[model samples]
Every structure is written in structure tokens, then in C-alpha cells.
Target: MDFVKKLPRTSSGHDTIWVIVDRLTKSAYFMPMREDYKMDMLAILYLNEIVARHGVPISIISDRDSRFTSRFLAVNARGPELVQETTEKISQIKDGLKAARDRQKSDADKRRKPLEFSVVIFSAALHGWYYMVFVTTVGEEYDKVFNHFGYVKCTT
Candidate 1:
């Protein structure tokens, strides 16, 4: 999640956009907001727009913005060791998700190979038909032009 700031203000005085992305699903949400929104306002917006719709995320990744750093530091101060352990677990989960996604992609590609091959064959056939028609048309035009110029076919 991140913020895109310093945008041109809208008519309703919004000059920033909150960008929330789900890494696993590759889904995203963009919410317009005023630049001066406080941390509490941000939390409320986050709850309403993200949490309310998708439920709570397992982990959030964001840039080291002051608000995020302050909030994160405050939360982790209670159990720094736990934070380290959680980070390791999150990394393992991310790796597993990556492997799963890769396997899914490979399976999908295997399933789609026949369809892709058929599409290529169909396109080649269509192009070949068009080329034949074009050559035929050009041959007819050449004959007409030669006949107009008084050229005759000679028989031996």
C-alpha cells in the first residue's frame, strides 16, 4: 500500500490518492483523499474501503512513510523478537505463494497449448486465403491493362 501525493486537487479538494494492492491476487484499489488526512482518518478509510471489503490482510507492505513507521514502531516495541519471527514467517508464506502461482501458470499454459496452436493454424490459413485472392485480383488487373495497351497473346 502507498500514497500518490501532490496530485492536482479535484473539485472536492482531494489531492492525494491511496493505493492499496493485494500482492497475491494482484488486485488494487485507489481511493482519492485530501492531503491533510490524519492517521486516524487514514485508519478509518482503510477499514471502510479495504478491511470491510476484503477482510484483514495477513501482512501489509508499505514504504517507510513517517505515519507508517511511527505506527509500526509503536506496535513492535512491545515484542521486537516476535516481530522478527513474524517477518520470517511472512517471507516463507510469500515464497510458498510464489511457488503455487508458478505451478498454476504452468498448468494453465499446458491446458491452453492446443487452443493457441489452433489459433495460429487458423490465422495462417486465413492469411493464405487472403494472399491467394490478392494475387488473383492483381493477375486480372494486369491482363486488363495489357489488353488495353493492344498486347495480344501469341500462339506458336
Candidate 2:
């Protein structure tokens, strides 16, 4: 989560945008906020904008802005267990993202393979036609030259 400050004020004088992103889904929510809102107001906004919709997140990653550093926002938890749980969640998210990327790349490769093959075949045919034109124009011994190079007998 982060804040984008110093934006142009709206008609109601809101000048900050709360930028909340769900890391697992890469989804984002932008909420307009006033610059001078206190801890309580911020809490209410958080509850309404985020918690009310997504329930609760497993953990939050933030820039630790002054609003977040306030005592009211702090949560007490067992240190080792919190660390382990956070680590496991992060590892799973990473693995899922990697697998998604790999699948996307495989699909892209499948789509491109036929196009690449077509280009190769088209260029070969063009080259063969060009060679035939050159041989015919240069001399009457086209068959001898073609047979000597063994190009006419070549198969796909």
C-alpha cells in the first residue's frame, strides 16, 4: 500500500489518493482522501474501502507512512510464526506467478512457430525462383547447372 500525494484537489478538497494493491492478484484500488485526515478517519476509510470488500488480507506491505506508524494501526503477533506464515505466502505467490509466465510464454511460442516456418518456406521458394531466373538468363545449360548443384532433386 502507498499514498500518492500532492495531486490536484477535487471539488471537496481531497488531494491524496490511497493506492492499495493486492499482491497475490495484482489488483489495485485507488481511494481519494484529504491530506489532513487523522488516524481515526484513515482507519474508517481503510475499513470501508478495503476490509469491507476483500475481508482481510493475510499481510500488508506498505511504505510505513506516518499514518501507518501510528500506535492505533499496530498489530501484535508472535514473531516466529508471523515470519513463517508471511514467508510461506510469499513463496506460494512467487511460484504461481512463475508458472503463469511460463504458460504464457509457451502459448506465445506455439502461436509464433507456424509464422516462422511459413517465412522460412516462403524465402526458400523465392530464392529457388531467383536462381532459376538467373540460370535461364545467363545460359541455355540450365539443366546441367541445376543438376550439377543437385538443387532440382532436393526434397522438403
Best by lDDT: 1
Clashing pairs in 2: none
* Over 4 Å off, model 2: 57-156
Q: Write the per-residue lDDT of candidate 2 for residues 63-154, one digit (tens) a residue.
A: 67445644543563668878999999999999999999999999989886332111111123335533222412322444464555444523
Query: How many residue pairs clash (N, CA or C atoms closer than 3 angstroms) in each of the candidate models, in the order given?
Result: 0, 0
Give residue 3's error in model 2 in angstroms.
1.1
lDDT per residue for candidate 1 within 1-156, as digits (tens), equals 899999999999999999989876899999999989999999999999988988975556566554786687787786879889989999999999999999999998988633211111111323331111222322234345345644443322
Using all chains and alpha carbons, the TM-scores for the candidates as numbered come to: 0.37, 0.36
Residue 109, candidate 1: alpha-carbon lDDT: 90
